[model samples]
Target: MKALIVYGTRYASTTEIAAEIGKVLKENGFEVDIKDSRQKDIDVEPYDLIITGSGIKIGSWTKETLKFLEKNKEKLSHKKIALFAVCGATRDDEKQYQEAQEKYLDNIQEKYLTKPPVAMGLFGGVIDPNAKYGIMDKLIMKMVKKDLENKGIDTTKPYDLRDWDEIRSWAMELASK
Candidate 1:
């Protein structure tokens, strides 16, 4: 089978996850193409499976990914599509994280896109306080840091928290189908 893996990432974590998925799929004997969602255009009809992922920021998927899905809803519905979101919040609170991710999926479903995504996944994201950020992002991070500190949460360490085995398992199942 052939698969297309598309991703939208701001700090490159989601992109790394997407590439890893593609690598695992390829190792499992399926042909795969990995691309950034910002590509000028995507020809989705040629692929047997479509896997799209994005990093979640402020309880929402990236705007570029949403736009890609919105623009390709018609063509996408005819193929096997899988969705995933990378977020730091999901590491500790899966339910809340998934609910936030579902809002994006719900929007796609509401658009009347037949055959919505067959599978959805959430992966933990990376957060580096010292990393460069835009004005708004910096402000938001500062607020979040303050809140976490108030709650006695330590924010000094960087944790990956992504389960490679789980990711591989998911890809294997999708490839087997």
Candidate 2:
């Protein structure tokens, strides 16, 4: 089987998650190709399964990801698609997780897809202090961290909230589908 993993990342956390998914798919006997939407374009015709994902920012998926989807919507309609998204907001609460799924994953499916994905995952994301964040962006991140801390979330310096086990489980399930 052939699988294509395509995604957009803002600060590289989403990139890492996409890579992990690719690894799992490869282990399941797939010939996998991973593409970063910002740097490259792909012809989805050769792949049996295509997994697409994006990082969320300000309640939106990365623009490049949306563009890629829009560009290939016609061809993608014939393939098996599995969707996933990475976002910081999904980590803090159960309610927030569902909301994140609805906003980042479901809303996207509704807007761009004619058919529902065979699998969907809404996963936690990272906030790396080492990334090239601008002044305003830094301020916003700091404020968000402070708010979480104030709520007794024990915010760390560089928040690494990704749930690896859950991520792996999701990929394994996608392999079956």
Clash count of each predicted structure = 0, 0
For model 2 the local lDDT of residue 14 reads 92
lDDT score for candidate 2 against the true structure: 0.87
CA lDDT of 103 in candidate 1?
A: 67
Instruction: Spell out the clash pairs found in candidate 1.
Output: none
- Residues 33-117 of candidate 1 have per-residue lDDT tens digits of 9989888787788898889888877767777777888888889878898888787655467687667666655654555356767
Residue 107 shift from truth in candidate 2, angstroms: 0.5
Prediction 2 TM-score vs. true: 0.93
lDDT of the candidates, in the order given: 0.78, 0.87
Runs off by more than 4 Å, candidate 1: 104-112, 147-154
RMSD (Å) of each candidate, 1 decimal? 2.2, 1.7
Clashing pairs in 2: none
Top candidate by lDDT: 2
Question: Could you give me the TM-score of model 1 versus the true structure?
Answer: 0.86
Candidate 1 displacement at residue 73 in angstroms: 1.4
